[model samples]
Target: MYLCSTMKKYVDVILPLPLNGTYTYAVPDDLSLSVEAGCRVVVPFGKKKYYTAIISNVHYCPPSEYEVKELFAVLDDSPVLLPLQYRFWQWLSGYYLCPLGDVYKAAMLRG
Candidate 1:
């Protein structure tokens, strides 16, 4: 993956909410490395609490609907998760009939 300093790219993130799909956010220049996939970030969702979400992917296209927001903060200097971990969570979520956020919560509690 490219480092965060090259160009400011907007990313479309999938929050662990019961919503439709992804939301767009502006990635800050200084926070490039911190915004990679599997890294957690604080984002403003709706009008209330700032939700912690993972950056699923990065893109250049602007969102068509809602106004994209700036990333509030990145929660990690390096990715907290690996590809295998993500696959494991996906399997657990499917088998347990639970949300991915629930799995994330359980992992956090153990840590």
Candidate 2:
């Protein structure tokens, strides 16, 4: 007999706000196949508010500090942000001493 196992997945998203660090959200099984880095996902930000955030990383490791929330929805079937653009934003944020969210806001067009 063989044993099968499933691993829990999570994503680190970059919200377009003037805040530092990425937020980790749980990837529901239904959305796991669609979630990827560079893709935008709707997630709860604070009490009574939701925000569209860009996925920065996808992994199985769960955060040990705070309670992780489930993703609200996936905005794109494919990644809207290119890999190069994502890296550029990271570099710009680090070099300029600004938050990644600020870089993302300035780089992306408003909808």
Candidate 3:
């Protein structure tokens, strides 16, 4: 029998804003396997207004500096962007000195 790691799980999400980094969010029992990279998830930011964010990384390490919040909802049955596209976004952000979210915004808008 195989056992999953005991480490706490967290999902790094890229919000649809001009922000620089992905925010970590806690994964409730109901959303574990349903989430994946490049998938859209609705997450509450600040006091209100749930934003559709892209799941960048999902792993078994919870952040230590702040409280992680649960995902509001997962909106994609299939991933929105491929891993190659993610790599391109990373390049765009680094080369342009822009936020990954900005890259995502530009990518998401291109029909």
What TM-score do all the candidates reach, one by one?
Answer: 0.68, 0.90, 0.88
Each model's Cα RMSD = 5.0, 4.9, 4.4
Q: Considering only N, C-alpha and C atoms within 3 Å, which residue pairs clash in candidate 2?
A: none
Model 1, span 5-111: residue lDDT tens? 33557876656665444578987778765677778888988887788877767666656566667889998877777778878977887898877767766774344
TM-score of 3: 0.88
Q: Which residue runs does candidate 3 get wrong by more than 4 Å? A: 1-8
Which candidate leads the pack in lDDT? Answer: 2
lDDT of 3 by residue, 1-111 (tens): 122346556689988788988898887878887988889998989987788889999887777677778998888988998899999999999999999998888878555
* Better lDDT candidate (1, 2): 2
Candidate 1 deviant stretches above 4 angstroms: 1-8, 14-22, 109-111
Tell me how far the alpha carbon of residue 100 in candidate 1 is from the true structure, in angstroms, after superposition.
2.0
Candidate 1: minimum summed lDDT over ten consecutive residues — where? 1-10
The sequence of per-residue lDDT tens digits that candidate 2 reaches over residues 2-63 is 12235888899999999998988999999999998889999998998998899999888778
